[model samples]
Target: MNKYILNKQQKLTTEKIRNLADSIGIDALGFADASEFTGYTIRNSRRRDPKLSLPEAETIIVAGFYIGGLTLPAWSNFLYGRTSRLYLSGFFLDVVKPLESIAAFLREKGYHAVVCDSSDSERSVLPLKRAAVRAGLGWQGKNSLLLSKKYGSFMALGGIITDAVLEHNTEEEPDRCGSCSRCQEACPLHALEQPHVLKRDTCLSNFLQIEYFPENAQSVSENRVGDCEICQDVCPWNRKHLENPLKTHMTALFQQKIHYWEDIFYLPNLIKMTEEEYESIFKDLNTGIPYSIFHRNVFLAMERAKKS
Candidate 1:
């Protein structure tokens, strides 16, 4: 039988959980009814060991927050640059402890609640933007990111899926990206085949993370590094959010990771370090920039810089 029953305590528990999440550094906790998520297209397309995650999450609380601003330091342009992407950086890292704490507390409370691993392999959880939509947080913008009329897509998503059935206070918004194609038009590689229809293989960010680089990219520029935020950057909604706290979400790595590119005019530095060294220096921050990717992008940058 389902372990949880909805009651006044559930309402109080939701508020307490939200309060605790904020105390942990989350900016907002919006609930989405995901009774229909986690099947069909998503389940069949990806493969992840379900044992690595919890099961049967009936109610999902989506978290959206970010860190942007001057505190947003540019990724280092010079090799051995003393800035690090190999670790968490920026504002988002501030909330990790609090997020974890809330999860632990809920476990103690006998609720079958758990955080959806943002990087889960099956990625079985509903997309975070969809979660926001179910919660009435905002409308999905053209970029396929949930754009709060007040906020934007420059946000990170975290969620707690629970067995507690709660009312959905959602007001779905129409796509507000009418006649405006900034996100698509501004894409560096024409990655957006059509609005909300990105050609995944061509997407720079996806390419950086999941696939091998093109032979042609071996000679391309380095300004676009491990992850590309170009599409998100050009959205009219995102543009207006330049000053919003969420725009510059930094994690622990932002405050303390080393960027190395002292002499990129020459491409030989790519060969200067052994793979073992690469693994050692970058092992900790492998969450985003795994060594192979980090090295390949940097090496590619060095190659392109000289050609330019």
Candidate 2:
């Protein structure tokens, strides 16, 4: 094929992929040349090795999904009840399912495509926030979350690494969160060290998901465990968008109604369950929140409530 014909075909293929992604509720999609991320190092964990994860990657297709306001309550709920499980499971399906479909589409077109879930901490190959920024999807906010002008920081991300020589977005998202310290001041654990920098070790959100709670995070209430969103809640960007009536109604539906420790904990039921039973119930709901860790968080919350 002539150079002009080949370029036209590539442009059409890229457009087709974007259209497919949009149809499945992907809020935004962008592509970045994989070469731009060569030798990239992830700061949070030393174990991540991107090159080893996706060998000879030529393009990275970044996908974003705006978290609806109604789902916010479930994410913040301490008890991890039915509503919370639904929201967490929905997130995995929403993000991963679409990437799987996209990867299949790419594979059908004779390209080697590898789908990467944003929640994969074990083999967390690439820094997704950086990939999103490179694709011109958004800028890294002061809170260390990717902030899109349209969706703010309330979004989930996923990506696909492929050998296809796809078109790339040249534009970069500039830092628009100038001098915003609301997220910093809101963190009860004081996790934000500086703009776009985070003390991951001291982060309450990080501590909550791990196997053991940190001693430094003792002051953080157990009710605030499991994906704490205090920083995101206080962000002006998030607040502005959360004012929608639909979201308000949704949040109200999932709002915590149980006041007593016994009612919230269901201590009798939890205590009766065997370790195997507990794992069977919560294993797949949240990627990192295992049964034992969740039980510990519930126990702590109950203890705190009793003390008060």
| True-structure lDDT of candidate 2 | 0.66
User: What lDDT tens digits, residue by residue, belong to model 2 across residues 141-196?
Assistant: 99998998787887778888888778888899899888879999888778896778
TM-score of 1: 0.74
lDDT of each candidate versus the true structure: 0.56, 0.66
Best by TM-score: 2
lDDT of 1 by residue, 12-120 (tens): 8778877786676665567755455443245543222222344555577777665333223334343321222212333222223345677687778887766654554
Top-lDDT structure, candidate number: 2
Question: Which residue runs of candidate 1 sit more than 4 Å off their true CA positions?
Answer: 1-6, 38-40, 43-56, 70-98, 215-221, 243-284
RMSD of 2: 5.1
